[model samples]
Target: MSDQLVMIIDGMPHTGWKEASIARSIERGPHNFSLQLSEIWNTEKQVNRRAIEQGMSLQAYLNDDLFMSGYINELAPSYDANNHTISIRGSSRLGDLVDCSTTGKAFAGQSLLQISQSLCAPFGITVHVDASAKKAANQIFNKSKRLDLGEPIWEFLEELARVRAVLLTSNANGDLIITRAGTGYADVALALGQNIKTASGNFSGRELFSQYTVSGQQSNEPSVKLESVDTVLPIATVNGSGRYRPFAVAADDDMDVAGCKTRAEWQRNVNQGRSESVVYTVTGWRQTPDGRIWAPNERVIVSDPYQGLLNAERLIVETRLMLNERGRNTELRVMPKNAFDLIPEVESAASEGFIR
Candidate 1:
């Protein structure tokens, strides 16, 4: 059976798109979509120019499953001698956080969940904090948390996420998800000459470095005594196997020595993983052998001899679903599973039954 793509605008469902694309990423960011419709008409054979408008609430669905909840941001209608088309573009609710600045209010010992709720409540965005992230958030802050004036909410949250070693992602329904990475797994595997229609690899080392140093001030006093030393700034370093290139970064203001080390290691791992990346295009908008819809942030097993990968598990970083004259296709960008720095989700007995 063919999958259906429906967009509900102002409580009305429309499915007459001629070309469309939906892009989503595992990163805590916005999912975007664009649709082109050739002269939307009503049952009375009249053009429905009022069907779509900017700022209208929109919900996108695939096979009755809600995929995106957002607002229409752009509307372009064009008419030629014989062809008339309407192009609509929008992003998931997270787009609001990305575009708008935080209130710059300071949080005094507030948990991440509380702070997130305060920031998202204004935009009607919901928050779902994972158990692990909640635990991390509960840690006592050495100093009061404050947002920079006119700083985008997304950027603030991303900085916090890095310091806490968690991930900021969103659900299909557009709710903000503060969680760890690799918590989910894909049921189907991608194999060469099988499910993947096309595969390409990017093995660039421009971003890789031989060493990474993160320097910052630690909040706590040093446990060990250094002879005749009053204080020392905490600094952490990680070494890589690239050209003698060196990289250095400043740790977050709230980070300690341990956090600095974690950040440095994260930088190394993520860049190394990104240095050797792969993109796979598979026919259809879902995985083969199971027909499950493609999703980001899920780990999947891959076997591609041409890429020198054999049963290697990888993480799905992004997914782009496209429909055009050629047909429907799902393009996936994947990297090594260790590219992420968040803690892995622990499995429960009940989850083992369905988790692959």
Candidate 2:
């Protein structure tokens, strides 16, 4: 057996999917052990070999799993030999696998290395002496960047210190008023907008229109529609590819410039011109002079940096965030790069049990 010690780094178990349907594979974390090798092999070779031979990812195989594993993986680690206190100044990993974070500290007089070796032994893990925490951190960092899937995503919500409004329901009474945390002002502005209800059960990202489904009894199954929108640029996007940052929008319905009365009326009233709010349903993108509608790849925003002039093809993969979505944050929210890598779902065929 290798002279290295191995210990099971306990971590939390997680499988990212709804329990009702659509089951995804379970993600596993790796084992963490405290090691202290004699001044012999280089740290670089040891860490690299551990990652490759074990066939584990840093975010997968080590760091993250250790942290998330709670009782097991997140165990307080120590190292020593001969039952003496070897004051460990610090601990770190080598090579590039640094997605998870580790904590270290300067130690006083003690024999920590001996204990580390003893504990690391019998478990099949080896402990090596290394001085650089940066190297180990790098190992976790580099590996996490390249991995396709990762830990669950959580969103942090802050208090609405500004005056805000909660939309009760779109059940027609429209007089829905909700009490908010903030006393007034900012919260008030977030209150009732011109038209916050839609035919669908979704709110308006553009801040002017609400979407209500109107497909008769089949309203639960949404029908994606687009109306024309001229003039002002849309802050959110219709692209389903969830790669875009704060501006990532996936609303199925929206109002347009023609019916965009709030801003227009404000401007008209300021100029003392008698005009109605100029808002309309968001019409589909205009046809190109070549007699074809814009392709999904055509850039909706020609000036944007990340999505500048990109086409609509990516919309197929956007996360359907918001409205009655469950959880604090929508688990459906996927990173843009990952969304495109998805494979189309296969159809299931009816197969009776095979008769022997």
Number of the predicted model whose lDDT against the real structure is largest: 1
Relative to the true structure, candidate 2 reaches a TM of: 0.14
Per-residue error (Å), model 1, residue 272: 0.9
Please list the residue runs of candidate 2 whose C-alpha ends up more than 4 Å from where it truly belongs after superposition: 1-51, 54-57, 60-213, 218-227, 231-356
Report the number of backbone clashes for model 1: 0
Off by over 4 Å in 1: 40-50, 211-243, 248-264, 288-290, 342-356
Q: What is the C-alpha lDDT profile of model 1 across 1-356, one tens digit per residue?
A: 67888889989999868999998887647899899988634544545565678989889887776878888889998875556788999999888999898547777776667778889998988999777577875554444666777888887777566556778877777788887766678878999988889999987767756567776556473112111111211111222222366677754344556656665676777776766689999888877533678999889889999987899889999999888887888999999876775632222332222112
Q: Which ten residues in a row have the lowest lDDT in candidate 2?
A: 154-163
Model 2 Cα shift for residue 81 (angstroms): 39
